[model samples]
Target: MTSRRDLLATLGTVSLAGFAGCSALPFGDGQDEKSDDVALPAATVEPISWPESPFPVAVPSTLAETHRDRARELLTAVPVDPAVPNSAVAEELQSDRERAADRLETDTQEPWPTQELSRWRDRRHAAATVRGTYRAATGEDDAEAVTERRRAVRDELSAFVSAHEYRASSPLEAVLVHAPIEELVSDCRRRTRPGSGYPADPVADPFQAGDAVGLVEFADATLADARGLRDAYLADRSNTSAQWVPLSDTSEQLQIALAHTRSTVQDFLEHDEPPFDADLDGTAGRWLFTEASRRVETMAEEHDVYRDDGDYARAILVAGRTLAAIEALRTTIDGINGDAYRDEVTVESVTRTAERAREALAAIDASESPELAAQLCRPALDTVELLPEVIEEGYADAGRVQGELAWAELYARAVPAATAFVSERLG
Candidate 1:
């Protein structure tokens, strides 16, 4: 198990780029622009091309039963509290396991994007780690002094988990633009602490206590990945016209986006799924999207802090998702009638387009109206993944963007209606 000190140290040092000399890049946008003082990245960036249409993963009853049977496999060794929420713990863990399994298969199968292969595998590994933590917390290793240690571990993890917001990439556009949703989903699910269910209060219920502990260790690892992607943008920022906004603005934008996301999810749950060109209206068709929307809403409420306190990494994560939510809602309702990509989508062209995006971001001065700046900044951060320096070999990274300029024009379009969405209800 990773200690609290170790986790903080790791988060502090993590960078998006691991290659040597990558950290020395300038923070400025290379022109006569004022510094926005954004920090490093924290969460991973989902691509903008993944399917926005929802697809459900049915967890067979037999499979769920199997996991439930083994949920208490580790509890027998330790002196567990009689009130341990075994069923709730099992359900949450199994939900994670099933989701990870489904994503692993989908990500690896033919035609689906493989650019995020490593992230899916890492989630699989994380699910296993949760199992391990569950076992360890139950005193599987040394039954002698388990109770005291479990409480201490849970307290530490609870504090860490509360500090970060974990929500799925809402709106299909956000899902497509951001990194893999499983990363956020898994993190959010772990924080559920299903054992206690409501309020998720940290309890001495050892069998039900591993969720927080496992998420803490997993967070440390994901932060490193977030750094790699974030640093990639930082390194490229000096070349593009993208300017930074105040961390407070970024936080405010995130808070607004999150609140909007919650309301959107509530709307989604209350009404029928928005009519898609495809036949995605039935229960099976809407299951995954509905569940994800619910989770996003729950998370928005759980970690509703409005101030970032100068943490740039947190700002980047929030900004990226908020932008995705904005764009996704547009796509879902407005509908992409035909190909949304441009005629030419080469690396150079995309880079030029991305620079235009940065220019747009730079142009939206927060001094004009912090709310508009906050709204537009989300789209600006969404462009980070489009930088030529960060392009990789995969459908999301190269295929769609290279083949069709997937999200190349998003930032450019975002500039006109940063504040109009409220009046127009466009999003």
Candidate 2:
């Protein structure tokens, strides 16, 4: 293995190579007189590739049969609330089952096939039985009933996790299988206080379906993941005789790479012409920078948590993913134009964009012929009216909110002719 110093030196070379293609472009939107003279630094991006698929492993035919039988037994026995005739959790489970039904079909790769498909199909049928018992659980007046059912379901889930330890042949394989399961269990353990004053609901309704169907789906996925991990571990173990690299070495390299990328993004925003004008202009650019920064910070936080828990393998996997996200952000940043479409997708940004659209609408309403103005800008006005709902109910992430803002701005700008006409009449 290369020393950390040597690895970083190699990364620096790659960063400089990436920058070579970008340095010649003129900085800014032709707004600054000295923009043409500004020199651009190379983006400190490292080349991080995803793990290769562990295929062509020898799988025992009986493995699938055992999995299918186990899935049917577990799912058929899941409990539900006695009183709630119609649960929102049931609707959610049916939807999830339908969405996952397609995974039942086997892919081109084979050898250990039929059992996985059977397991999925059996789980789907079991879901029908689950949705039937939870009616009326979604109503506001039934919050107590929903919480009661949730607690019951959570108790079962906690027991399941505690009783089963899904292990694999290798550390990396073990990390992949256990991480998602542990994360789910941790969420289940959190105490939900009614007036906790958190940003949003810690989990979805009924805690993202603390119901029979949801529990079965979770069990099936966990088992499937464990199966896949076992296969991969066996394959890798057969193919490679070398020992795994030291965790400290990889961790140090990731730390240096993250710092480098963070600094590069900061440098661009600070020194580039047109500035970091997220409020009025370059919204996408600002958002890209903000998200990239957030991801870098998150990677560091994840690393700390994993290390403290002595899960070095999981930390390494997270670092790889973080690098990939940073690389993608850098690519998007390179493509940014002088537009607000990609601005930081926050509640504030959403509200601001909606206000700008409202101002445009007011101008049209105050025109010499209000009726004609409405006729001319009907589509724009319709889109602007929908903004209040978006403002009231925030989005899942920065990307989604950013896209909404961008489209809203696009629709607002589409009515340039109507706005111009209104201004002309008023003048």
Candidate 3:
């Protein structure tokens, strides 16, 4: 009966400690200066060495010979596209970047003077002036206006800092820039059109525009790191001989899968269901609700396979969070007892199907046989496939069911095509 939080906490404690230990050893006393010197033979005193290049010298590769080509292939497979930018997510990320630029400018322009108290007082006064201006321009209860002003302030600060020729002196520079940017992006992408007919509350929607942006950023960074590693390994590939390759072909397979998953999720978010019932009440709500449930179930099933891989945890977390949000929406639909909302019964039934799919996912063990995992995943997939029918039947009104039916038709057509593509590639 351990909760997800409990499991995550345990995993964090164990995994982090294990990784920390692998990174370093206990420090010891400094070596004697005499021991560091090495005497050259008298015959080699003139010291004739290999010619140095005027350009940067290429370092020899460090990886074992067997892994060189595999590493190359992996590096080549890294996706280069910046994530497809959603305007809302872009705005959030830009705001974060501006904030960092402002902070950097302020710190550089008004560094501590000789007198601590004087410096502190000066900073306080400057901050107060800025605050007064902000408040005057954006009154209380107007969050959007406040946000825009904050962004403007940050942009101005960044420009000032850049003009001042201040260099990044500490690790905090990158931290300040990357952390907020990542967070804003994650938040913006979480829910698509928050108040859409989807049964889930806008607050609880799983897909954050921000998270999508962050994932793309993370993937790009990982690819860069991998490419550097590959280049270094390949530089010395000729001299080293090894029993087994250090880089596996599986890296390419995993990258392709990740790219596909990102694309699929993005597609879902941008997708617009055809106009259904004129009323945005029960019929429309039920259709959107069922679609949301099905999408969540599909994503959860796909993510379950990669739970064991450290890099895939973000995807797994996204899927789980989305599934939980859909579940909550279902609960909300069930609780709507008013006569006007009777059509929401479909939302309840589809939600049960989603829960069953989630249960199947929880039962799956990545460590188990691949065949078994695939078998388990099929039932979950089947459950998702049933959602369209549930919506179509429950909302028997032709106009109300149009959008839901179209999506279901698309899902049915696409799944087989996708399956065939995977089968052929893997076969």
Q: Output the number of the lDDT-best candidate.
A: 2
| Residue range 289-359, candidate 1, lDDT tens digits | 33233323433433343132333323334344344434443442343233233233234544554455455
Comparing 1 with 2 on TM-score, the higher-scoring candidate is: 2
lDDT score of residue 147 within candidate 2 = 50
Residues 91-158, candidate 2: write the lDDT tens digits: 55455434323322323122123323334434443443243222224432333444554456556655
What TM-score against the true fold does each predicted structure earn? 0.31, 0.37, 0.21
Higher-scoring candidate on TM-score, 2 or 3: 2
Better of 1 and 2 by lDDT: 2
Clashes of 3: 12
Sort by TM-score, best first: what order? 2, 1, 3
Stretches > 4 Å off in candidate 1? 1-147, 153-344, 367-383, 386-399, 402-427
* lDDT tens digits, residue span 7-89, model 3: 22334423421321211011111221221122212221111111121111132232212132332232232222212134453
Residue 370 in model 3: lDDT: 26
Backbone clashes in model 2, listed as residue pairs: 85-135, 86-134, 86-135, 86-136, 87-134, 87-135, 283-342, 283-343, 284-342, 284-343
Residue 105 in candidate 1 has what lDDT? 36
Query: Stretches of candidate 2 above 4 Å error?
Result: 1-224, 239-245, 266-275, 278-294, 327-427
Rank by lDDT, highest first: 2, 1, 3
